[model samples]
Target chain A: MPAAEGTAPLAVILDQAGLDGLLTAIRAKGWRTIGPRVADDAVIYDEIETVADLPMGVGDEQKGGYYRLKARGDQALFGYTSGAQGWKRVLYPPRQKLFSAKRTASGFTIDPMAQPDAPLALIGVRACEMAAINVQAKVFGDKDFADPGYQGRLKGALIVAVECTRAGDTCFCDSMGTGPEVGTGYDIKLVEMVGKAGVTYVATAATDKGAKLLKAAKGKPAAEADLAAAAKAVKAAAKQSRKMETATSAKLKDVPEHARWDQVAARCMTCGNCTMVCPTCFCTTVEDVTDLKGDHAERWRKWDSCFTVDFSYIHGGAIRTEVRSRYRQWITHKLSTWHDQFGQAGCVGCGRCITWCPVGIDITEEVAAIHDSTKGRK
Target chain B: MAERKRPKLAVWKFSSCDGCQLSLLDCEDELLALTEEVRISYFLEATRKIEKGPYDVSLVEGSITTPHDVKAIREVRRQSKALITIGACATAGGIQALRNFKSVKEFIRCVYAHPEYIDTLTTSTAISDHVSVDFELRGCPISKHQLLEVLNAYLNGRKPNVPRHSECIECKANGIVCRMVAAGTPCLGPVTQAGCGSLCTGKDRGCFGCFGPMETPNTAALAAHLKELGCSGRDVQRLFRSYNANAEAFRKESETHG
Candidate 1:
């Protein structure tokens, strides 16, 4: 339906063809589209071209130490709860070459790595992931230590967030106050409601750029009925089965020596998978590579994890020698001290850490175990 | 150009496949330039030219399996300024180290027509077990990049920039999916050293751990998870007892299983 009189529509209803048109419009704005795709038996985020590239009929199951992709029976584009990998792989990048140095007769000649030519257009982003992006933005783009590569990628990027209508077993974003519904920071907000309309999507423009792009899609103005249905769907998602006590975020640092840490550390592989999959874990280390002939040298910045023994390295040896201390540092900093440091808890509750861990050590369980044991004790 | 005398490099082999030694030759493009950086004095694989003792850097490959190998390693230690062991065999004990669990006498009787003709040690041991090693490069065949780094670091009088962390770090750094986590495959990446660029996992296979145990590896923790991931006790044991079988952490963990 068209908008009433001369007023522009606040929301639009996008069908199959309209979705494709939206992707085209995003491309027209000179942004490379990236979204979830069914690869390696998991819905991992990669460069996507058409609507066919999306995980349309796929559903994902995630638990502590477990993640599996299954057929959703019906064609629901946003059926999956969370992604195997987060957005950091694109924004901050996994491994980035900082600079390359070559030995000249006069002095050393150094060249910095080039910036990306085109900006990114992230499609099908979840609400929790939006929060994760914001958290990482703060981490990388802070005044004292601004990462140009990260800030540049984020600054020129367009975000299309999809409000989740289903909560996975590992999801606890409702309690974290970050998800199930799109909060601030999204450019375009889409609520995927698979109802009587059959795989319907309510597209609401969150920014002026989003409004101009939505108009290009030529989708119908969203009726009042479609808007209400979308609201009901998000309300269902808000019924989070797995709840992490927000209060636990404040006291996690207090119980550093808690017995629960040893128990959790027993199962923790310390493989650093948790930090790898976490969208907010932004620690990095640099390595210098030289041609064996020693003529040229290149330095690379790689994502480092707190779980590794080398993460706490000094002159003599690593401080966190034991897995227990490393585990304590990761969880403590993620839930508690992060709030003190960044004014927001590090965990966005996407639960990628829980799903991608080889041994399935649940972070929420560890936090709750300590939270319960330390209850009412001043 | 300043007339700086090049350092002497000696490549020695012991009792195993020449795969690790081949890794040096495998630096096909860099090999020629490497010769310019150092004098190819004592490499039997590339050059039959054997130079005198007191070499600048010695790259020793293979395990010390026999009495002759044990004595030779000590002599190599005395001659070389820096002795860097290469591959699983020299650093741990190669696949041949599997014999460390069994009797060498029985094996000789099974393989050889005359058991009396064979003169072999009961166990295959690392170069470090015999003499002082400045460094040890891990892998069934060392990573070509790491080999160059070691050569570059020691030759330039600085510590090698080889990371002693788990393979998981490398896998994540390269955006390789966790085969063990995503597909429920049994992997040794959590316990194995960071090298080989997470080669196996990048190919959608679990890490067989060509690189030996990482520094401060908790093998027992990995073993438990491997078992939970549908690896049987013997399966878990055999997994740890593969290329780097006789490495201390892998050896101890394997012994705990069947």
Candidate 2:
């Protein structure tokens, strides 16, 4: 046990012993702890109940069109970056049974799905992921059309945000001003310093829930040295990130119609991988599923990408049939038009689109190309 | 002596992806309530139940691309008291309008093995060209809220409070830092109408003009800006000839550049 904070906050060092102890403690709290664990060949976000479940001494290597897990020199439980799956799967499940209906003599009786009763403790959340959650909150929790399912899942959930110490080649959260260090929108933020001095975890509470959690944990008070080390870690991560300049909350009207989109469209595949991986992309399509008996029908809404030809199809035919138009729609809406609708730039610069894209399409490169092309004309 | 009546509502399809109609169904919570307010007399996408018209309101989707479509819309016009065209297809010819520049024959041959089976008009034109449209709800897929607003306005006997302003005004109100100035990203928000809630820009991307051109859009100035941004003449042409390629403002702009 390390020196305690004013009270006994959790004092485990997150080493082999601490990892086991922390997992045991979390389970003892009667809460489900979700963290990064190895599944198949890649590290995926999943449920973890033991130290063995953690991806120790592993870090993700990500770049434009590349993502892989690599070995680290030291064993650190929360050393890895984010993976293909996000905490969103836990909160806003991809496929949800909204409401089931059964046919009656007069009409149908509809039954909405029951809300999640169990509370969740998300461990190893990155700052960018936290921002993504914040964005979803506005759409699902803060609005008049509040998603009941999202509300129920997020109501009492605890978020343990781990400040990113390593920036992937595709990472550009700094450009979107969402990360490098854990900003707002987390319960507890932790910065890990791994070196010859073993590993020191500097933790701070961002919300009352986090404060309460810290109070429950038996840990030492974080000193000024610890804070400085955390700051240094954030600075290094910020420096490591590839620069991507973006306009925050910029409107579409400011941009003049130019040839830049066509240039980007030249290479765009219209596969919609960018939108699928995008944390903020919220376009959806409704599907009507009728029972085989044809007595009752159910309507389901699923995520839809603007890249699909059918997405823009009108009565006569599909609008934006060409790859160029689809790419143009996707990028412009994200950077420019989204400001008009949501009062913010759609991109948080997670660089997931850049990394996940099969053809390695880089948004930063496209923007630069457009900027360079028009350099003299303006 | 019996109280006669709910307002009759008809949903007609032309040449669209059925996304706009799906927008109506997406209003899961509101759909049952909406039915109580107005009788859904002829929505094939929702129910096979069809009633003879002189429909109180007819919501039309898609564009007039074939001779049959042209005749069918005329019959719909005769049967409806109010006609509202939803989505880019009905209001501005949508993405299919891309073929307006190229030869329709060549396009058919390139895309389909059985080109002869495809009986399509040379150009996809908006419903407004053939028949009078009471109002036009614009978008690649019409915003559900806007769709509700239009329906409510019609029901309440009020003018729909749809903004005619460009996406720029919305961006400023939303406090979005301009993508063009900050990131040097090429965008079409300036000329595009306000709707879809600045969605593309909010994601740190440029606008693709899915909502179509706003009233009195300065397409020439926008084109000039695009030219300044190093967009080629062909690029400028392609930009105007997108979702709303057949819309007059965008069409003229594309022609000017081409």
DockQ of predicted candidate 1: 0.63
**What value does the lDDT take at residue A354 in candidate 1?**
86
lDDT of 1 by residue, B219-247 (tens): 88888888777789999999999998999
Among residues 3 or more apart in sequence or in different chains, the pairs in candidate 1 whose N, CA or C atoms overlap within 3 Å are: A65-A360
Worst 10 residues of 2 chain B by lDDT: B173-182
What is the C-alpha lDDT profile of model 2 across A1-378, one tens digit per residue? 122456543322333454355456666777798888875445667788887888888877777656667788787777766666567667765455666777777878886666665788888888788878877777776656888777777776877788888787878788878877776667767777787967667767666556656655646676667677778887877864565546322433344465766665655545455776677777666644543233455666555677655678699988787667777788878888866666666777778788755446788777766655555563
Q: What share of the true interface contacts does each candidate keep?
A: 0.59, 0.00
Over B1-258, each residue of candidate 2 has an lDDT whose tens digit, in order, gives: 133367899999998899999999998877887887789999999998789888999999999899899899999999999999999999999898887778989888899998878888998999999999999999989999889878877775666756654666455434344455334466777678877877888888888888998754657766766776678888888888889888988899899886
Question: Judged by lDDT, which candidate is best?
Answer: 1
User: Which residue runs of candidate 1 sit more than 4 Å off their true CA positions?
Assistant: A1-9, B1-3
- The numbered model that scores best in DockQ is 1
Model 2, runs deviating above 4 Å: A1-16, A248-257, A314-316, A376-378, B1-258
Q: TM-score of each candidate?
A: 0.96, 0.57
